[model samples]
Target: MSKNVPGIMRQKPITPWLYLVPSLIVMFTFIVYPGVNTFYLSLRNADNTAWASTACKAGESCWGIFENYHYAITSEIMQTAFLNNIKWILIMVTGTVALGLLIAVLADRVRYESVAKSLIFLPMAISFVGAGVIWKFMYNYESGTNQIGLLNAIITALGGQPVSWLTEPQINTIALIVVGIWMWTGFCMTILAAGLRGVPEEILEAARVDGANEWMVFWKIMIPQILPTITVVITTMVINVLKIFDIVYVMTGGNYGTEVIANRLYTEMYKSYQPGRASAIAVVLILVIIPAMIMNIRRFNEQEATR
Candidate 1:
């Protein structure tokens, strides 16, 4: 930005760019270079000795460059992982945001708002891995006297069978989603509470005076007023959902059909020792996230404009 001086605007020169040199250097070194290289590697065969081929015949190398992308798209495990990632986004984002908004609204009317909020938001203080570990113990399903998991213990006490919570594909996915929701709900509550606090008290009074019921006011007025905040929260949560790794990694290690994109990339790169496939997966993930990042940036700009 330039200021008008004596009816003339003067543009800054190389000095401004000079000031950006250090940060730009770091960005290019850490982000830009790696990103470019990842794309390059993604185009190479799984072994990276040559360009990838699309052939998938007998006695032929199926680890061609495009083969990784094809495998990612066609493999049963990859499909499961992709679908589970979608499930994660839907459950974690909606559940966390909805629960957070509910808590935020309730806290606003409570005398012990700070205490209630502190307790609810306390989970946000725990690391994702720690939260997963805690929940793992909670879902333990040891046999007989060795049963120590809280869930199994409670079930058994209620005269029910002790079920394996994390090892079963059908149940494990949902179980991991629950842990994600728990870890992130507090973050949503804190942000939305701030957004709610920013609402004008006078507007709320006006709505009340107009005979708007609490539910009506919440849905029609308060929510609309904080819509921008919700948009930001949703977009942030979506991004988080896409990169979700720690909780799933800690609790299931992508086992029993609980894999997500990041976890797959991890296994492909390290566990399976397939850099080309890993880079391809990375590229696939980056492509998926670009649109979301763009939308978030646009919303951010819109928010700033309003403020």
Candidate 2:
């Protein structure tokens, strides 16, 4: 038995890999294969023709290497779409984290904390497409004596002009961002609230004894202790902001300067039948998401290591 111990240890090592085989197969089939195919397709011309092709599709005969990329970057609509994605990252990420933290902090001390959190977190339960549809009706414009849109109705009641919430570029992006914040703030709040709960009550009592004011307790003790949770929330929001599609698509169909990277990719691949350009956009989106995902994974590992 002692002499056979080494062989048993070797068997254990192989068993883990054997157990991983199914998961590895699934990842390769669903993720790795599609990813490689997308990159290869991105390098080809619009008509799916490689250098060996005798001819191209009728309208895309002129397509060549670098042609789709050039058009994707140079097109005015594409430029606007890229810009809109940037704006979303800036506004949505900041707004969601800030508002979520604020709500979490305030509600943590309230008598009806559970009720307050449940109300705030309700939007997170709804799908993004459903939220977009609901908001769309709320922003509907009509040239009439009365308006159903919440904002327009409020403006008219105040004897002010009704603004086109979704039609104008400047306001449309912000309006869409409001929807994102509404949907995600609850998620942030929930995570932060859990972190808040983990905070040692004894430590807070000690801070109070040390002459620390409520504000000081929050800034010095509460925030520092919850820093890890805050990082997790912000990174998660950043990833979501990068991949935002449903709201922009359902609300505007990438029109009126509300276009985003995902929307552009969908349009290029499906509507325009330009697989190469769409793939390029997809690759870019992946590149943007990879860093955020890495940060999240590292944070998670660090939390586990601490535990």
Candidate 3:
């Protein structure tokens, strides 16, 4: 038996497959099956009892096999939700990365750097639901009563009228995006801070020695060095913003024009009982996320190769 080592090596490669069995089983069971089922359900009617072809009733024009997908694309609510997700990607990602980078650079030069970073990152420890509820109160409005919400209280104290943070359609989505930015800025700061720490001090000193002011050194030297890290952060934020759900659900239940893709999926699935529509939304969301995910993977591979 001890002398069978060479013989064992010559045998079929079943050992690796055996090791992979459990993982493959788990992946198929949890990820693969659900994804396939979702796509399958997307082609059917609301409860999957009928083909999407029957979605047309008599005089109604039929969209054939992809009625749900059509609805996902053309429906007003879905269009609004899609646009909101795009808005989230634009504003929240920009604000998060910009503020994070600025704070990271400033914090690095400060005396209590650790404390400063810790305070900024504290919001990340809170669950999104919790953060939403906290901000909900912070944005609360009571017209007749004395303001209890912090923002309104401050505004009223300064002789300004209370602002409707959540109800107004014009600014509600922006309000939600603000909460997202606040919660995620700390995460961006921590990652960018690590990137900043990796910069070669000699290059920075040399640039300054060549008469580059701090601003010029930052933009010309530090930024280019950390551009990869910034790209990763931006893509990560994009993906996060695309699938934003918990906070929107907790705070507004996707009301007042704050709808996003994931929130719309939840609404269709649970509230409206439109499983087909929900599945269509899910598929669309996956498609949207794929590009960002691919970029992130490429960036990771490049980093690994350079190392």
Candidate 2 local lDDT, 34-128, one digit each (tens) = 99998787777678766313223466534455555555677688788878878988888888888888899899779999999999999999999
Order the candidates by TM-score, highest first — what do you get? 3, 1, 2
lDDT of 1 by residue, 166-224 (tens): 99877898899898888888899999999999999999899999999999989999999
**lDDT, residue 144, model 2:** 68
Clashing pairs in 3: none
Candidate 1 has its poorest 10 consecutive residues by lDDT at 1-10
Query: Residues 1-307, candidate 3, lDDT per residue (tens digit)?
Result: 7476787466565878988999999999999999999999999998688988778678765689899998888899999999999899989999999999999999988999999999999999999999999999999998944998999999999999999999999988898889998999999999999999999999999998999999999999899999989999999999999999998999899998889999999999999999999999999999999999999999988878977
What is the clash tally of candidate 2?
Answer: 0
Highest TM-score: give the candidate number.
3
Instruction: Give lDDT per model, in order.
Output: 0.87, 0.86, 0.92
Instruction: Give the Cα RMSD of candidate 1.
Output: 3.2
lDDT of 1 at 84: 92
Superposition TM-score, candidate 3 onto the true structure: 0.95
Report clash pairs, candidate 1: 52-65
Candidate closest to the true structure, highest lDDT: 3
Please say which candidate is ahead in TM-score: 2 or 3: 3
